[model samples]
Target chain A: MQRIAVIDYGMGNLRSVSKAIECVADNAEVLVTSDAKLISTADRIVCPGQGAAADCMAALNDANLINTVQELIGTRPFLGICMGLQVLLTHSEENDGIDCMNVVPGQVKRFASPLLDTSGQRLKVPHMGWSPVAHSVAHPLWDNIADKARFYFAHSYYCAPDDQGSVVGQCEYGIEFAVAIAGQQLFACQFHPEKSAKDGLQLLRNFVAWNGKS
Target chain B: MGLAKRIIPCLDVDAGRVVKGVKFLDIRDAGDPVSVARGYNTAGADEITFLDITASSDNRDTMYHVVEQVASEVFIPLTVGGGIRAVSDVRRLLNAGADKVSINTAAVHNPELVQEASDKVGSQCIVVAIDSKCVSSPGEEPRWEIFTHGGRKPTGIDTIEWAVKMAEFGAGELLLTSMDRDGTKIGFDIGVTKAVSDAVEIPVIASGGVGELQHLVDGVNQGGADAVLAASIFHFGEYSIGEAKAFMQQQGIEVRL
Candidate 1:
């Protein structure tokens, strides 16, 4: 049986994320752990995170899994969600400029727009609710999921990747930002698939079946 | 694309079981909280709000378990409220799989609890729920007053002012319910709903007094609520989440149908 490790660094909504994975996993053994050996040995890894970048990195460092995760990124079928995607960038404007894992070349910045829609109605900060995400590049995870499908979002900051090729999905919240990024053996999204309903569950199911070739 | 207007189904849970009552009495068991939430999820509820009506200390564990069960299977944003007193309470619920924690009586009492929880847990996870009722006089201007203790006790705080203050205190969202209209199933108090919603910068979820599907549309269009929350209309199967979303969509409201 294939083992999938969901790295737990003591932050984020681990329970829901793990449960969503378990709901979709058939032959795969889903494990939520901070154990480096267990994560490294797993066939696939999901690095799910929430909260601020500084706190997230601190928890990761406290667990001594920084290097372990860095090694797993290129070697395993890795998935990042929300802060999991932000922390993979080079840096973030949050917490007065915190250095990230730099697995992907990018910087996370806050939504500095006037926070208004075209009609002049004030847009709520945190950007909470469902917003349609438009795909830029094709990937196995996008299979069966319609382009521009609505996904649940609850974040103030967004990722600005240096390598545009890594961006597979973009969403507009006063300003268009990368909502999903894909790379060799890696797939990351800003929205929470666990909270996204049918399309989200389908994406997770696809991730479980993906071979990480592209 | 802009954020879609949400149609949330609120479950009033008592002793780990989902129940819906009129005016906070005559409780009738709807179903298990987890199962009801799962039904809403598959039925296409934009979000789910679970309010523990009997938020007693002994029942805390049961509520947490219900939240966990629902979060695991529902696969949608879950907001849990009731009996949340402090930052610690908010932290516990979030860890238990709630995406947001709604604080009511405690927030009205301490006021600072809103800011403290917002700062500690991030404003995105802190929701301030205000229960208010309109007060009118023969020659005086009508105003809404804040109520606590499940809308039994009225605080002197002005509803609009309190809403503005709550938003300034870093509350990411506000769940505003009109006490007089609650459980009446007539319609939302558009005056108070618009008052607070227009007063706050954060998203406002207009709740209470939802009799039919048109009430929901009025809540969003007339009340200017970012979302509309209903209980009996959904809990009793008079309206399904899909039907609500369809109605909202037909009304030109942006809903994920």
Candidate 2:
């Protein structure tokens, strides 16, 4: 059984993500932990975050989990969600802008579109709800995840990775935004796969199964 | 892009557990809110709306505790209503981990409360909860009227008008429930939703009528709701959040998928 360590840095949504992982990988040992040792020893990792982007990074820094995460990427299976994904960027526009994990070479910015609808309104800020995610090619992380899965989203800022190829899934809310990305064994999604239901569970299963094979 | 439809799961949380019934009566199928929220969150829920079903004001502590508990547990953005009346209440909930607070009875009595709460918190943090009943009276076209105090007292304010006014006062979101459709599992009040969504610039969540995935799709496509909040179907495990999102995507609406 693949050991999936759900990195918990006193952040939000640890339990649901664990439950989702459990639903998919019943044999997999899904444990939520902030300890660097457990993260280092785990076969794979799932990082879920809520609240401000900077706060999430701060939590990691406070807990000293950043180095462990850095060491795992490209070697061990790793997934980041929402703030978890945002913190992987160079920096975000959230909360006076804190430096990110620097794992991905990019800056997360706010929506710049101003085009309005027939009612003279463009998309609102904090693009909430389920938006469509499009991708050019399949990423291994998306394994059982469908081509156009309507994953849950609640975000105000978006990651603008310097390397465009990293983005594997895209969602359009008045404007297109990166929904999912893959950089070697490191997979991240702005949408909440833990809360995304069967497709989400399937994605978790794929990560575990992929980890097992890898 | 057209207005996106949202599939929301309603949670009537009490002591950290989810309690549901028809028209707010005959409660059955009580489940843990944390577990149920996990179910909806994984199922592709657009957003989760939690209503404190506990009637006693004394449960404020427990309600606050539950809100903090769920917020700590779930990562998705959530809206919390019920048992919230003052700016302090709003402050406590937001501080405790809720992204938005829904106001109903308080706003009905003191329309200024909307502005007050919005001023203290950002307009984006306040949501106006309107429980409306369809009234077809002589010399008046058929329209939904706002009700307050757990849907018992009629405020006589037009539902659409109330939504618009609340927005003007800094209430950024509207959680509009149709008293006639709630708990019936029929569907949402598309007409009311369209009227309110057309009337306000802020996002409007269509609640009350949600029987199945089709209802959620209709609420977004035809109804013009930014999101759809339902309790029975998803809470009871009848329809999963992923099925509802896929259903919405199939209808040509943009969803996370």
Candidate 3:
């Protein structure tokens, strides 16, 4: 059976992500592990995270998985979710400016305070709930998913890729921010596909079927 | 387009079984939590909230099992509330596949629990549930106070102040319920809902007394709530989540339909 390893760095819950992938990938052996050997051997790597950026980076270093993650990013089909996407960037402004993996050349920014919509209503921080994500490029992950499809979101910071071309999906709260980013053999999102119902499930199905081509 | 206002269907679970009671009384069996959640997921609910009304520790395990089963198949954001007193409880629910855990009475008694839990598990997963009731008299400046023990005991904390403090304490969201209109079905207490929503930077979910679809719209447009939650109207099949979303959309409020 094909093997998919979900990197576990002792951050948030990995069950939902693994369970969601399991629900769709019938033939893949979905393993949640921090074992470097296991991850190196997997067909796909999914890195999911929650909580503070500094803490997440610290955890990655403490678990000795930073090198493992750096090695696996472009070698195989890799997917990142939420803080997982943030930590891949150059650096984050959260926790008084924390350095990240620098795998993706971008800065993570916090949503400006007192953010307002067109109607002059103050948009809440954390930007919680479902928002429509507009695709910026045609890729395999966007297959079967509609343009501007709503996905679940829960975060205060967003990714701002230095190379705008890396952005594959954009979502607007107070400002239009990059919610999905992609490169050769890799795709990541700021929202949790595992928790986002139907369209989310379709995205996972696409990820499973993808063969690391653009 | 921007963030769409959320429509959440709340299921009150007691000892692993889904139950609905009017004003916390006249209890009746609704159905199994997992099946009901699955049905809501198909009907286009933005998220699901399971409030465990079970009072004993022995019965709490059932809530965990119910959350796990529902979360495994439903695939939407699931929030489990009630009887969450410590950081461990939050971890337990998150381990069970719940996306978030709402803290109510425990938050009021030991406000530090909110900070500790948020610090331990990201603030994104910490939700502080507030049950507030109007304390103002007619023809007076509107005021409200937090209530505990199912809105029977007042905690003397000002509603707006508590909301701001919770946000400062790292609460990612607030589930604000109006005790005065909880079971009345007249509508939400737009005054208090708006008060708390405007006072806090985090998203607030306006709950209680949603008798019709228009009430859901009012919760967003008028109350300024990022999300609206209701029980009876959905539990008894009065209006489907899709219909509610359609009505809200007609009223020019963005929804996930």
lDDT of each: 0.87, 0.74, 0.91
Candidate 2 segments whose C-alpha is farther than 4 A from its true place = A113-121, A212-214, B1-4, B7-50, B56-81, B84-148, B151-173, B178-202, B208-223, B230-257
Sliding window of 10 residues with minimal summed lDDT for model 2 chain B: B21-30
| lDDT string, candidate 1, B1-257, tens digits | 56899999888888888765322222333467766776677778889998988756887778888888888788999999998887887878888899999999998889899988876666778889999988876467779899888788978899999999998898999999999999899999999998887776688999989999999999999999999998888777787788888888898998887
Off by over 4 Å in 1: B21-29, B136-142
Clashing pairs in 1: none
Write candidate 1's Cα lDDT for A24-110 as tens digits.
887889999999999999999999887778888999999998899887887878999998899999999987899999999989998
How big is the positional error of residue B245 in model 2, measured in Å on the Cα after superposition? 9.6
Error of 3 at B161 (Å): 0.6
Better of 2 and 3 by TM-score: 3
Chain A alone, TM-score per model = 0.97, 0.92, 0.98
Tens digit per residue, CA lDDT, model 3, A120-183? 8678998899999999999999999999999999999999999998999999888889999999
> C-alpha displacement of A124 in model 1, angstroms?
1.5
Query: Evaluated with lDDT, which candidate comes out highest?
Result: 3
List pairs with backbone clashes in candidate 3: none
How many clashes in each structure?
0, 20, 0
